[model samples]
Target: MTNDMRRDFANREELATYLKEQFPEAAERDDHISPIIGGRQAAVAALQKVDPVKYAKSRNFLTGAVTRLSPYIRYGVLGLREARDFAFSKIRNQDEAAKFVNELGWRDYWQRLYMKLGDGIWKDQEEYKTGYSASEYATELPQDIREGTTGLVCIDSFSRDLREIGYLHNHMRMWLAAYIVHWRRIRWQEGTKWFLEHLLDGDPASNNMSWQWVASTFSHKPYFFNRENLERYTEGVYCKKCPLYGKCDFEGSYEKLEAKLFPKGEFVQKDNSQSWQKGKRKR
Candidate 1:
């Protein structure tokens, strides 16, 4: 079974004693650098240095404004509460501090949902009934999506960014997920697994749950994005650079794609069996 829950170390004193015995090398090292310590320190420093003003203004820029702390959280290097407290302690006002806190809450929610649902959350209900096949599709779609060869410029750029840095902007993740599910008709579980394999911040709870959320499996109504939303949110930054700006079928709009997938009031729900099939295929 994949362990997706976070663990607490009981107390700092006990944790220190255990680390001394279990990790002698780490204990002796003066710098004491690990995912948790490094992540907490990095978060604290970012909070102290940037605080409300910088984070508020530049968090969405996608270049370098946001704190890259997901790997630490994913690996249990840093506890969620510790990170939250550190940020709250640094910020003077509650309202401004809430922005960062809400982001952390999202992490907590993903984990909670995973614990509550377990593997059932990953299956697709429509596959068996509709005779939706995944094996042949999985072999091809993952390569095309990961290689950025799907002919979708924004998605390709996001894929390339993830391959190079194991990171993508928050907005880019949603856009990529939507395109992969609705436009490409690839299984979200397949896409989610591919991400976990490559992403430095591959937390099962967050990664899987977020993919389901985007695919609309968690909700009755599937969340779809269009060209206008992209243009407004991305500030038309992707318009000129995207390879599929006008030539491709989607044309960077989800309305047409949605109509095609769910014609005659038929909703395109995610198939959870895709997750298990993917696991078997990987083995």
Candidate 2:
């Protein structure tokens, strides 16, 4: 073959077929490709649909009004300022867009931190505060979890979505991370690698830092959630049909969960309502 290569295709399927033929090994490894389109046009279309007010009110839920612009921003097909300006144009007041803007601010913060930390972000920033030593955590991710057959409906769904769709709601991301680290006692780095492999918007900085946050290496305490908290945010969609409902690992009060998950750690727990009031204090 010469330096010149084919760049034109009649459709996405033709493109996918050509790619698979050229990179058969990659296709063998994991052939699933995301349905989310690329390029500036697709990015602008996604940006035009941003609903900041609805996002602020419902971003925590599974079917909320999330602006699916992360992949575009991550790849520079869309710029952060462009997204912010467009969101601001849609909102009537500053408060209406505060939460959405705050999310963008976090992306900026993670990028800056990545620049400073370099490769150091992959290592633990601090000691794990879960009362157990680093040696106690498992180094390998379990096959069941990776295959989305762990039998917990919520977790399995998230795992499948991560692998197949290359996307997940932020709340679901948190819950899944918590399950891997706290419940299964796996090292955060393992989960980090799994996410980076599948997420289209996965940036090492944001992904690693967030994993460390849940692992308690970058945060004050290990983040976790009770059944009630999960059900409330997910609207009980997973729990209602979950075969292990009421008997699963997540079924308990926050206080009970804290004591069980981190018996030797110093993570404090108050009543659910009071503790979860500020930030991730409840977890």
lDDT of 2: 0.86
Task: Put down candidate 2 lDDT per residue, 52-96, tens digits, no spaces.
Answer: 999888887778898889999999998889988998999888889
lDDT of 1 by residue, 88-167 (tens): 77667777767667778878877776788788657752342112344423423567787788666767787877766666
What are the TM-scores, per candidate, against the unseen true structure?
0.67, 0.93
Off by over 4 Å in 1: 1-64, 124-142, 252-257, 266-283
Candidate number with greatest TM-score: 2
Candidate 2's C-alpha runs over 4 A off are 1-5, 269-283
> Which TM-score value belongs to model 1?
0.67
Model 2's TM-score against the true structure:
0.93
